[model samples]
Target: MKQHLFHGYMTKNVQKRISEATTAILPSEREMNSGINKARRAMTPTIPTTQLFDIAEPFTKTLHDDDFLIVDKMITRRQRILLFASREQLKMLLGVDTILMDGTFSTCPSVFDQVYTIHAVKYDQSFPCVFGLLPNRLKTTYHFMFQELKSVAMQMQ
Candidate 1:
């Protein structure tokens, strides 16, 4: 099978193309899906079962241009928080006086309880500056996030 077909297309699309290319009997959709899943698992790095998994190398930077993406990673007594922002984003955030902060719970990964975002208003437009994956909504969590962001921003100036 051509490897490129498996790279970005959906499973069903790959399966259909593969089936059409050959005359031999093909595996059922369920079996093909299971095999595809197994292949994906084998290629991916193993993640810690607990919440303490280290960010893998592939995820540490931006994919297209390879710019640094992680601003901070903090582990407290109750939770682990990962803050993601580019240096330019941080500078924009620090430049503005009126910033907006919002916390969302529904779209976060299972390992995190919330996704907190900081937005900077520039010329009446709000641009997201920082994305934080937090474990809980405690006051200390917010404090830690803000303190770390401030530290990063200070160092950049």
Candidate 2:
């Protein structure tokens, strides 16, 4: 398999190839994921808690363009919110008349309580304009998020 598949290929792609080669035996997706995660953890360096607040340069920008960080602010003494959106996304958000917002608590990082997202509808399609990792689901937190976004939008205009 090593001779055929490239090094650093995704676990899922490797699993698929292996399954195709050996039709009778198949590894469960969860097992493959576990193995991959274990390997990754062993290879990656651990970061201190203090350094988590300082986002690295590579992560501070969008993949295809310039900076993506829209806002990084503390709404309260203990709560910090990190908002990300590309300039194009912000422009689309500003041009649209209708926007939708939702918050999910399950998939956010351990330090954040919820992942709040804002979407704008234009030409019958919805585009996610902003993604925010919020500390809590309080009304004040939401208010602050909106205010920060509004302030950025105002500056853009």
TM-score of 2: 0.69
Total clashing residue pairs per candidate? 0, 0
- Candidate 2: 10-residue stretch with minimal lDDT: 44-53
- Candidate 1 C-alpha lDDT tens digits along 29-54: 67988999999999888755556776
What are the per-model C-alpha RMSD values against the true structure?
5.9, 7.0
Cα TM-score per model? 0.66, 0.69
User: Judged by lDDT against the true structure, how good is candidate 2?
Assistant: 0.83
Worst 10 residues of 1 by lDDT: 65-74
Off by over 4 Å in 2: 1-52
The residue ranges of model 1 lying beyond 4 angstroms of the native Cα positions read 1-48, 63-74
lDDT of 2 by residue, 1-113 (tens): 58335545665576667656574465676787799999989975565243147776766798885889878887766678999999999999999989999999989777788
TM-score of 1: 0.66
Which of the numbered candidates is closest to the native, going by highest TM-score?
2
